[model samples]
Target: MQKEAIYHRPKNNFAYAYDERTLHLRLKTKKDDTLSVTLIYGDPYDWKDNVWQYHKQKMLLTGSDDLFDYWTTSVEPPYRRMRYGFYLEDESESLVYTEKGFFTEQPLDTNDYFSFPFLNEIDVFKAPDWVKDTVWYQIFPERFANGDSSIDPKGVLPWGEYPPARDNFFGGDFQGVIDHLDHLTELGINGIYFTPIFKAKSNHKYDTIDYLEIDPQFGDKETFKQLIKACHERGIKVMLDAVFNHSGYYFEPFQDLLKNGEDSKYKDWFHVRSFPIETKPLPSYDTFAFEASMPKLNTENPEVKEYLLQVGKYWVEEFDIDGWRLDVANEIDHQFWRDFRRTVKQIKPELYILGEIWHDSMPWLQGDQFDAVMNYPMTSALLDHFAHETISVETMADRLTSLLHSYPDNVNEVAFNLLGSHDTPRMLTLANDRKDLVKLMYMLQFSFPGTPCIYYGDEIGMKGGADPGCRECMIWDKTEQDTELFDFLEELISLRKSHSAFGNSGSFHFVSAKDGVIQYKKETTTETLLFLINSSEVIQSVEDLSLSNETTSLFGNKIKPNTALTLEPFGYEIISL
Candidate 1:
């Protein structure tokens, strides 16, 4: 036994409430170190005749990453409280692991164990229930389509006539999105995450000019309401981008600050280092990424807080949008987000809140702030393994396992998972234009947990490098789009919707990942799904698939049960049991 490798904590990913009644506990040990683990747990107060009442349950080996194996189990305490410790066994020895230290014998008293004090229902992390079933499609409105050229922005170029630039617009609007409702429906995605459709100076719309008004290039308020109505009619939810972290240079408040300096009534609205603001190497005031045009708002200010909070409430209250994808959420204060959550959820209890945070975001996901972050860590793992081939299949599996165990199941379920957003290079481009690699990437994405998001043109095999390039206009001509890839993506989305095991609530575990091939399984209470993918050029054989009697081929070529199967180069399979 690798005693030094044993790890656990009283809370967080190691232990947490799956809900009010159930507690999920996990322990980590060095890879292949512990032969078995038994969880000895009971309410700390459940004592009779000077002996603590307790129960012991065997923990299952849930997953392994490159460095560790994760053991997990779910238990229900009659009293909604728990004190626990672990018994580890290996060929060489047996030992007790407790809160204080490792021991040769189990501790007699419960005080030596870790305590979960109590499971508070109010503290449970509850994301929107609908998010678990949603497949999101991200649209950069300015580059998606040109439905009404009459509302085109000044100097707008012909659609798809040239490569995208930082400040260029091709007249994409809500009307265009309304026109393409059928496309989204046929593609089988149930949610639309539109980036910054509010009034802004730039084409991407992240630099907000008005939080309450829709950008003229996208359409007016009424047209947006119509678009939302159209989407809801088609069984699709709408999520708008909220750029509350900063304001554009031309925003009325910011402009006034630039003009009035110290005398501006809105002087407290933003952070200012000096009387005369400068915007050269660095601004005299704080900005988003040192960009002078984008000034960070002082969300702590009372007036600014009220204004932004109302902005958070306006869209859902007026247009009935289903969610808000907060821009640069990590840069803002926690209290403001908590108030924002209260304001929005009061309007619609189930409305989703996604944050554009690129790193660890546990602080914002405790049910009091944003429901989920953008999940860029998982995206990086996928890209590193599938697109760049910089990491081995085993390494990828380990990375994913670590990520999945980093948060509670509820958080993982609603996490906004995406691979080529407007911020990154296209999946196809990253895969070096290899459709096979792209298919493999999407296969893993759809099969893995979380709500998957497709960049606007990716399903049709649109390819480009990073930003400006990746933000190309959506291809509308059927003859020009890659129908084969689109159809395949549609099939994948359909599979996700129809199968319980593919849903975010299901369990995901790696079956195998070695010699240029990977296999994983997703298990729900009602079904089990196995995905076998070979990313190498040579045929790969996986033996002893361990199919049950109810196993059947869900997709890919049919194979015999409990027998070895050969996968062609870049081939994959989805088996249901």
Candidate 2:
């Protein structure tokens, strides 16, 4: 046994309350090193004489990545508190692992075992239930449509007439979104995540000049209210972007600081390095990435915190917005977010709070700060394998397995998963314009755990490069849209919503990743779904799927129980058993 590779802890993902009564525990060992693992646990005080009374339950090998195998099991302690340890075995020997260290035999002292003090129902990570079932559509308001051209910004270009630039605008507004509600409904999107619609100088609206008012270009507060009402009437939830990390150059406080340096009462609102603020060369203050125009706010300041908290509360209390997608959330202080979560959730207990974090966000997702973050790690891995062809299928499977084990099951269930977004290249562009590859990527995204999101024009096959290019105007002309690709995605969204085993309710596990083919299964209480995708250019065949007699094909080719299942180049199959 590789003792160095064995590991466990009493908090976070390794051990957590899955619900009010159940505590989920996990143990990790070197890949293929341990043949079996069993959980030895009991209430800490449940002891008689000198021996500690306990029960042992076997842990299932839930997943294996490149370096580790994860074993998981659930326990319900009668007293709601317990101490636990793992008994691990390989062919050669067996060992008892506990908090103190490795032991030749199980320890009778409760102190030697890892302790879960109590399963507090309040500490359980609970996101809004609606988020798990939602299929999000991310709309960059400035590029979506221009329903009321009368409110068009000065020098606004004709829609889709030219390639997008950072400073250019096409006068996309709330009315534009309200006018085209049918597009999203037909696409089967139940949640709309709009990029910043607050008053700002740039088209992207990340640099906020005013948090309480809607940008005039997007219409006033009344128009936004109407948009929210129309969306709710259609059963679509709305999530607005909040840019509290920084303020635009024209933001009043920032403007005052630029003018009155030391005399400004708002000097503490920002992080100014020197008495005289300068924007040339580099600003004398902290800014978002070194951009002088976007000054980072000192969220630790009491006034700043109060103002932002009010901003969070005002939206939910007045407009009835369903959620808030926080931008650059990781850059802010943890306490601010904790207060933010409490303030907004108090008004609307089910309001979804999503953070725009691009990496591992376990610190902020402990049922305190954020319900979920933009799942960029998963996005990068998927893009690298399917779109860029930089990683092999086996490597892709390993990366994905590691990602799933990084968080609790509930966190993964509501994670904001996306392919292309306003920040990256379009999926088609990343896949070198191969529609089949894009479809394959979508297939995996929708079938995997968590809610799936689509960028504005990705379903219709709009192609662009990064940043400004990715923010192209939505293609409204039906003749120019890729209806075939649209239909494929529409079917996927429907499958995700209609089938229990095909969505977040199911348990996911990898079956195989060999011969350039990646296969996995999503199992529920009553049904199991098998998904097979050929990532290679050549056709692949699997001879022994070991399907049951009652198995049937939900997609792709149908085959007899013992027949070799052959898939075409870049092909896929969805089997139901």
Top model number, TM-score: 2
Clashing pairs in 2: none
Q: What is the C-alpha RMSD of each candidate to the true structure, in Å?
A: 1.4, 1.0
Q: Name the runs in model 2 displaced over 4 angstroms.
A: none
TM-score, every prediction: 0.98, 0.99
Query: Candidate 1 lDDT (Cα, whole model)?
Result: 0.89
Candidate 1 residue-wise lDDT at 403: 92
- Poorest 10 consecutive residues of model 2 by lDDT? 550-559
Writing each residue's lDDT as its tens digit, candidate 1 over 267-346 gives 99999998787888789998999899999999999999999989888888888999999999999999999999999999
Runs in model 1 lying further than 4 Å from the true structure: 548-552
Tens digit of lDDT per residue, candidate 2, span 1-577?
9899998999989999988999989888999999999999999888788778999999999889899999999889998999999998989899899999999888878999999999988999999999989999999999999989988989999999989999999999999999999999999999999999999999999999999989989988999999999999999999999999999999999999888889998999999999788898998999999999899999999999999999999999999999999999999999999999999999999999999999889999999999999999889889999888898888888899989889999999999999989999999999999999998899899988898999999999999999999999999999999999999999999888878989999998889888789999999989888898998899898778786664557754556787788889999989886
- Residue 21, candidate 1: Cα error in Å is 0.6
Query: What TM value does model 1 have?
Result: 0.98
